[model samples]
Structures are given as C-alpha cells and as structure tokens.
Target: MRCAARRCAGRRRRRRARGGRWRRPRRRARAEEGRGLVRGSSTPVRGAVLLYGLLAVGAVTWVLADRGTIDLWRHPEPLWRFPFAAGLAGGLVVGVVFGRIVAWLSRWAVRRTRWGAGLHEEFHALLGPLPDSDILLLAFLSAAAEECFFRGALQPTVGLVAASLMFGGMHLPVNKRFIVWTIEATVLGFALGALFWAGGQLAAPVAAHFTINYENLHFVRRYRPA
Candidate 1:
C-alpha cells in the first residue's frame, strides 16, 4: 500500500513539472506573438514615412533648382485640324483599357508571391481607388510635372538612363510591389522620357499615361467583392 501511494505521488509531481514547463512556453509564445503584431502595425507607417519623405525631398529639390516648370504651362496641344479629334478620344479610350491591364497584372503578380499579397492588399486599402476625374487630372499633372522633372529637364540636364533611374526611385515610395514594380516603372519611364524628348511637348506621354490608367484601373478594381 505504501509503495502504491509513493508511485501515485511521483506521478503527480511529474505532471506538475510538465505543467510548469508547458506554461512557460505558452507564455513565451504569446509574448512573441504580441511583439509580432506590434511590428506589423508599425510597418505601414514606416513605409509611408519613407516614401513621402523621398517625394518631398525630390519636390523641394525641383523647386529650388527651377527645372522645367514651364513644361507645366505647355497645355495639351490636341490635333485640332485632324478628322475625329485627331484620335484624342480614341487614345483616351485606349489608355483606360491599358491602365486596367497593368493593374490586373500587378494584382496577379502580387497575389502569387509570398509577401506580395499583403503588400498588394494594403496598398489598395490605404491609397483607395482613383476616381475617374482624379485619374484624368493625375494623368495630366503627372505627365506635365513628371515629364518636366524626369524627361524634359532631368534627361537633358542629366541623361536618359540616369533620369529614368531617379524617376523609378522616386516612385519606389508609392510603389509596394518592390522589384517588379520598379522594373515596370523604369520601362515606362524610359519610354515616356523618350517620347517627351522627341515631341518637345507633354501631350503624347500624358495621353498614354491616362490611357494606361483607364484601362487597368477598372480591371484591378473588378476583383473587389460587391
């Protein structure tokens, strides 16, 4: 009877020891989880600060340098004499379709990667969708301002490849998809820069930019659940 009692006490002690061990690990795990949540919460703010800070610096430098603000003054030189508005309306229609295509591509790429879905989802959530009017205005302003800085002034002041690099870097703040996004922007930047240099006016890139946005924006947003 005494041996059985001792065995029972030994089993109880072992269980208590095991319970103690399990408690520490669970506590530690919870603490680590809390830390992870805190880090995740701060990442977006950090990303935003980094991005906007870069853009602000770029804008300030542009203002101080007095580079190509006159390009903004150069209004849209539509083909006034051509039949059917010289394809202005048609070009814009194409741009809308193009924008949707790019956005769709971005969504697919982002969703497929390991860390990409979070970046893609958060980007859309934070920035929200660009309204039709806003997209139009942004395309115009971006074509003018961006062209002035990147293509007109910077390319001539610097060089083609160098200007494209800066242009891509400046967008890195607003871009979430990292290397892929940068690559896409770089290609577009090179083409847009080339067009601006060739045309000596913002019309071509502006139309193209707006068209791309119009095309892709709809496709990207199409996936959103009703």
Candidate 2:
C-alpha cells in the first residue's frame, strides 16, 4: 500500500507487531482519522473476498462431486507418513525459492517494458490501501482456493497442461499488463500441478502456494523501482 512508507518508518520506530491488534504511530493514527482514511471496508478488499470465496466454494463443490478423481491426500499412505511430511517440507522450500524468483522478475519487468511498469503500478494501486493483515489473509485465501480448484479439482480431470493453462488464464488482468504475469503464473501452475500429481495429495501444493503468496505479497508491497 502507499502507506508502505509510513508503515515501514513506523515499524522502524515501533516496539511491536500489534501483539493483539494492528496499531500505528499516535500522530499518524490521528492524521488518518482526521483525513477519514481509516475504514473497515473498501472496493478491493470486498471484491477479493467475494471472488476468493466463490473460488473456494466452487473448488469444494467440485471436489465433493468428483472425489473419485480428485485425491486430497496420498492414498495408501497415512497422514502420518514420512514421505508426506517430506513433500510438505519440499513444497515450502520450493515456495520460498519461487517467491524470490518472482520478486526478481518483478524488478526486471519494471525495467524492461512499459507493460511491466504498468503491471507494477496497477499492483500497487490495487493493493496499496490494504494493511499487512489483510494482505496475508487474502494471499492465503487466494492461494488455497486457487490450488484447490486448479491443482486439486481440475488437474485430475483435465490433466496437468490444461489445468495449468486454465490457472494462468484465470489471472489475466482486465487492463493491459505484462504478458509475463500470465506466463509466470502458468509456469507456477505447472509446478504446482506437478507437485500435486507427484505427491498424489494437496498438502504440498497448499503449503507451497501459501508460502509463495505470503512471500511475494510482502516483497511487492515494500519493493520500489529505482
């Protein structure tokens, strides 16, 4: 959010991460109150909630309807299995790695093309108003719901390529943006799909997805182009 500057500076000076609830500097808090900038609802947050809720519900319904095909956890291997634990651990590693790569890509894109710069601007414009908590919550919600629908429900039915393509397509921006966004998302879909297919479970993909979302959101929020 645009408040990244204030938030970052405040964080530098503040003592904590709102042990119970989020807080800001006394002066900044009063300033925001005066400007009527603090509120409980906004267009971006509401729209994301509705969209992600639908994706989650649809994924659940589809999975339930076609459980014969969609495998949530590895078969024959119990939840306590070592391989399953390893898969989740591996996914988390992959997620952190990918998140960093994408953040680098963001910087490169901004320097290379107008489309990239536009995408970066739009990214900030859309997310700039949100606080850290909402960003994390939405990132988790979107990643889980998306992985459920794409990797969990669809991959089994349509195979990996198709599911990955659909996943990338789902993220196309309404306005112009760098094509690399879709390209990267498609690649990510492929990676996630492969993760699901190999593990024969949802745990790895979900873990990886959440980590990537969390890491990337924080990176982009703070990142500034020179």
Residue 209 shift from truth in candidate 1, angstroms? 1.9
Using TM-score as the measure, which candidate wins?
2
Worst 10 residues of 2 by lDDT: 32-41
- How many backbone clashes does every candidate have? 14, 1
Query: Per-residue lDDT of 1-226 in model 1, one digit per residue for the tens?
Result: 9999999999999999999998999998665444422233335434544554454456447634765354431223322323335344544454445445655666676567654565555445753554444434434445445655565456656677998888887666454545556677888888766655544444556566655655544444344422
Off by over 4 Å in 1: 1-120, 173-176
TM-score of model number 2: 0.71
Cα displacement (Å) at residue 208, model 1: 1.6
